[model samples]
Target: MKIYSFRKEEGKKITKYDSNFIMSRIIQSEKPVHVGCMHLEKNGVIGYHQAVVPQLLLIMNGEGLVRGERDEYIKVQSGDAVFWEKDEWHETKTDLGLTAIVIESEELNPDSFMALRIN
Candidate 1:
């Protein structure tokens, strides 16, 4: 068993990100799942990118805009959750700043379980 506290963890500034952002890795294991928290300052942006694995972003505070491969963008606020499939291009930005928790995994194959269980 493991316990993690965002408040206790030190945030590392992501220098590679196109925009100003800080991230705190909460849980990283060989189990295939990774969890972290991202903080974006006002008017900050996380430039276009794609995840190698499936990802879930849960908005924790403030509001922001999310854009996918399409030209359209969606507004997201606290409590909102977003999912992105592997290699799906996406980006995020905010005028009022934002904080979110992110969960990602490469081993999210539901088909493997379905194959084992005859349903």
Candidate 2:
């Protein structure tokens, strides 16, 4: 298993379309861009976007909400992990600030299902 640690040194400030956010890359590969943890400043918001593969967003600290199609909004906090599917419309809003760990993989490990294969 590959281990990734998110420390302060790896933190980086990112801005897109006037939104200021911070991200730390604990693990990343050209096949799958993996971001371990990201800290969003107060009042920060990431615009609607989609991922190439499935992603898991685990909130480690602070609070936020995720908005999706049809005005769907889900409140998220520490210990809350939100799974975002590929090509889905979504956006994140930091209301009470935010800190989260984003985990993703390029391809699904086929070996994981060996024991359950009926064929």
Best by lDDT: 1
Candidate 1 off by > 4 Å = 1-31, 108-119
lDDT of 2 by residue, 37-112 (tens): 7889999887888756766566689888876554767677764556556666778889678988776766433223
Residue 56, candidate 2: how far off, in angstroms?
0.7
TM-score of each candidate structure, all chains considered together:
0.64, 0.59
Error of 1 at 66 (Å): 0.3
lDDT of 2 at 112: 30
Candidate 2: which stretches are off by over 4 Å? 1-33, 107-119
Judged by whole-model lDDT over C-alpha atoms, candidate 2 comes out at 0.60
lDDT scores of the candidates, listed in order: 0.66, 0.60
lDDT (10s digit) by residue, model 1, range 1-119: 01122331345677684866766443343566888999999999989998778776667899898877777787877755566679989888999999998888975433221111111
Candidate No. with top TM-score: 1
